[model samples]
Target: MKFAAFSGVLIDHSIQEALQLTKKLGFDGIEIAAREPHLSAATSAPRVKEIRTVADGLGLDIPVIAGYMGGFSTASDKESEQAFSEFQRMLEMSETLGASMIRVGSGGPNAFLAEDYHYAKAAFWLRKCAAEARKHDKRIVLEIHNVSLVETVESGLRLLDLVGEDNVGLIHDAGNMYITDTDYGRDSVIALGRKMFHVHVKDEKRVAEAGSPGTFVNRTKHGEEKFLQCRLGEGEADHQPLFDALKETGYDGWVTLECHAPFPAYERLEHDFRKVKQMLGLA
Candidate 1:
């Protein structure tokens, strides 16, 4: 698997600076976040091309464009249409930036609760997105995030089956599995199998006490507390098994490091990138 850095960690920095930092840290590629001070749907085509030129000049590949397109699965028809229109714009920008994949969320907890209807809605839009993506030689990937519809292996498989499109796949995030199941192992990887098109690497740790305000934390079904953002190798996520599983499955895709810890951006990037390299036997 090739290593990439998610630019969301450096949200305060410009896209140029983020790409520069990623390359300085020895990352093979970058996953651009569709947010402020970075590329977004509202960004002009010239700006997108400029960002692409800068990355190409630095020899950095932009493999995936990560954005919150989950709102497309909302109950409101008007809201879903607006969200999908924005998704199409992002998809166009991603193609312009030379990215082959775009990361989208599986709606939220409510979508999972209303499984049958939401699943069909998600499939309908995802199929449309996949068809559009194919026209641009790109793909639309659903990330397995907490509170998302496809947070588990079973749920993800169900959604994938519903979509039943070649260009639609899963971003197998072990950290998310840790947040939801506390099990980041080979079994999940084996279950995802060929449907795993991308990967997001992070770590999670359970905090005994309530975490600081604004921190991303969730409670398990049994009422245990877990923090989604933690220092690399300092959490419950065991990445070695994930690496082994990826190797066993011959998975060759972008493995982007997502640094959500409350640390200096460069520090988080350097530490997590090195840790993942070590885990993958590349350090």
Candidate 2:
């Protein structure tokens, strides 16, 4: 599998600078964060063209759009419609960015609806987006976040079934799965083997104290959050078995480096980049 990294981890720099850093760090691809304070997919076509040129110049293939966080659910029609519209906009940006897949979170507030209801609604939306994606020859990839309603493999599979399109796929995050209180990532690998489109490689180090209520207060405009982004191999995440499983399953997609590093952006990304490359034998 090829190596990729999230552009957000290198968010302290310009897109051109990020590309240079990624190339220097030995990543073969990139997952662009098309969100605020970064390159939003809703930007001008000329900007898209410039970014595309820079990516090509740096020899980085953008396999997916990473920060398209649109909340989707069946519990509310208005919310669902808004989500759908956001997705449509993201698809257009995906085309401009030369991204084959657009990644999204699997759960939200209305995620507690009945299984059938959730499945039907998810399927309906995916079908619509999948059609648009196909027009641009792209696919929709869903990242399985532990906090989401579709946290487990079974739920992810059910959602995939609901999506009901071959063009849809999965982006498995090892760190997220580890946090989810499950020992069955391999089981998920087996279940959604072929559907696996990309991988977000991160190792987690839990903060038991961080789980304490009101331990962190929201004083900033961005809201309160306290989880440290430790460098790879410095966390509690066990990626060895996960890597083994992916190898066994013959996964050939991009293994994107996700650095939630405790260090500064440059040092953290550089450190994690080298460490993951060595760990995955890409060195």
Clashes of each: 0, 3
- List ranges where model 1 is wrong by over 4 Å: 110-112, 223-228
Candidate 1 accuracy as lDDT: 0.81
Best by TM-score: 1
Candidate 2 lDDT over 1-283, as tens digits, reads: 8888788887878877888888887778888887655577456778777888898998889888875554555336686667667777777777767788887655542223335655666667767778877888888888876545566566677788878789888778776665564554567688777887878877665554464432222111223334434677887677777777877888888888877655676677678777766666767
- Per-candidate local distance difference test: 0.81, 0.70
Q: Write the per-residue lDDT of candidate 1 for residues 110-162, one digit (tens) a residue.
A: 32365587788877777877887888888888988777678787888888898
RMSD of each: 1.8, 4.6
- TM-scores for all predictions: 0.94, 0.86
Judged by lDDT, which candidate is best?
1
